[model samples]
Structure formats: C-alpha cells, structure tokens
Target: MTTDPPPEPTGAPAPTSTARGARLAFRRWRRTRPFWAALWTGTGGFVIFFLPMAPLGQILQVGVGGIAGMSGGVVLMAMALLILLLPGQRHTAGVIAVIAGVASFPLSNLGGLFVGMALSVLGGSMAFAWLPEKPARRRGGRGLLRRTRSAAETPVPPVSVGSGSP
Candidate 1:
C-alpha cells in the first residue's frame, strides 16, 4: 500500500530576506575586489607602456615597435588585471603573463626583461591572493559543507511500511 505525504502548510513567512541580503553582500564584495585589481593593473601597465613607448623608446632599441606594441602591453595589463580581480575560475594568468612579459620586453628595454617578469608574476599573484578562501572548520570537519550536497544531486530516501499495527 502507498502512503500519503504530509501536507506542506502555506501562508508561512519566508526567511528568504536574510538569504537575499547575504547574496547582495556577497555580490558587492565580489565586484569590489576586481575593481581594485583592475585599477592597479591598468595604472601599472600604462606606466610601463608610456615609459617605454613615449620617452625611453627613443633611447632603447628595445622599444622600437611603436603604438602596436604599446597597445599590446595595455591589452596584456588589462587581461592580467582581470584575472586577478575576478572571482571565477581563471588559471590563465600564466598565459596572460607570458604574453605581457614577452611583449613588454621590447617596449621597456632589455632591462625590462626583469621588470616585465616581475609585473607578470605580480599580476598572477594578485589574482591568486585576491580569491576568497573558505574558513577552516571550527570543530574539525563539522561545517555545513561536510553534510550537504548540491540540491540537484541529493538522493531522496525511500519510505518503509506501516509502523505501529502489524
């Protein structure tokens, strides 16, 4: 024989407001990080770009590529900055760094090899560091994450037969 499920009561107050507030707060925090990262990266990149393409380029044979190269540097800076600032999955900071580092070589002078590498590493490091880490367990693996599965994947348990009467 089949058993009927208990009726879910309606007209109850929802606790969704707290969840909404938490979501909003997380979103704001998420947005703020990359904002700062982008700003710093862009500023540092432009400084590197201008130093070579405008002034130092005249003296150093390394900076001879002109606007295209400088533009490339800007692009690299933007990418690197984004990688660091954003919260999502981006293991590509290394790739972005490679491009920026290589391109920065001619623009910043051969001496720039050192500087460019440093900047590239800095960009990657900043992104890695900027990402939020989950707090450690207060009671040794007793956190919510330990007991829960994603809603989509959770299995529903089966019910048994009658309990009291034979």
Candidate 2:
C-alpha cells in the first residue's frame, strides 16, 4: 500500500506593532540625533565664548576667555566630529557650526568666532582618535577555522568491507 503525503506548514507570524514602533523610533534617532547634537554643541560652544565678552571695553582677562573658549572649542569640535561619526547628521551640524561661528562674531565682539573655532578643532580631533576605524575586522577566515576544527572532531568515513582487509 502507498503512504499519504505530509501537510504544508503555514506562514510565519507577522511582527507585532510594538516591534514596528521600536524600529521606527530607532530610525528617527539615527537620522535626527546627530544633526541636533552637532547644532547644539556648536551653539553651546559659541555661547561659551561669546556671552562673556560683552561690554566691549572692560579688561578681558586671558584666563577668562582662554579657558572657557578652549573648553568650548573642544566641546564644539567633539559635536562636529560626533555628527560625522554618528553617520546621520552632519548637514545640520555644519550649518549650525558655521552660522553659530558667524553669529558669535557680532554677539561676542568677534572673540566668540575665534574661541568657537578653536574648540571645534580640539573636540573634533579628540573624537577622531576615539572613534573606531576600518581595516580591523575579519573577512572570510571563519570558513577555514571551521573546516579544520570539524576534521579534528569528526572521524573519517569507513572504508569498503568486501575486500576482506582488516
């Protein structure tokens, strides 16, 4: 007698709405965070340098602007680098950085421009050093490793028996 055929399996379950929402959130974060951060950092750096320089004639101390400006510069640069590194938002960052730098000039009597520029460089450099680079990953070497290990662990197939050999 002949046997009956097996039944077909049904399709996979659809992804839940929560998963969909999470995915959407992730996309937005990836797309928007970088630009916003870059802008914020640059603007903050500008303010750090510009705001303190008002009242155009007072004896502006070296320590006053230097420390703050330098620090601000580092922050701004980091933000810029982050925008680039983050892979989503440099356009916003670039625009904000330049605009803020320009704005700082008038706001802080041209001192902010210098300070912001300095900070941007310093921060960007530091971020560059910290960010991971290419040329550090494995390509197809896993296949070789797997073959060697399998040979060691598994036994060779048995030889034919009809020849009467031991």
Q: Which model scores highest in lDDT?
A: 1
RMSD of 2: 17.7
Using TM-score as the measure, which candidate wins?
A: 1
Worst lDDT run of 10 residues, candidate 1, spans 108-117
Residue pairs of candidate 2 with colliding backbone atoms = 73-119, 74-119, 77-120, 77-124, 78-123
TM-score of each: 0.44, 0.31
Off by over 4 Å in 2: 1-50, 53-87, 121-132, 139-166
Local accuracy by lDDT, each model? 0.57, 0.53
Per-residue alpha-carbon lDDT of candidate 2 for residues 1-166, written as tens digits (9 for 90 to 100): 9988887655754568679989999776555344444544555575555456445455255445444544444555555666756643455455555554444444443545465544444433333333223445675698677767855687789988799777
Q: Put down candidate 1 lDDT per residue, 47-156, tens digits, no spaces.
A: 55565554654545543455545665677677655565554634465456456655666555541445554565565456545655566558746466656757777777
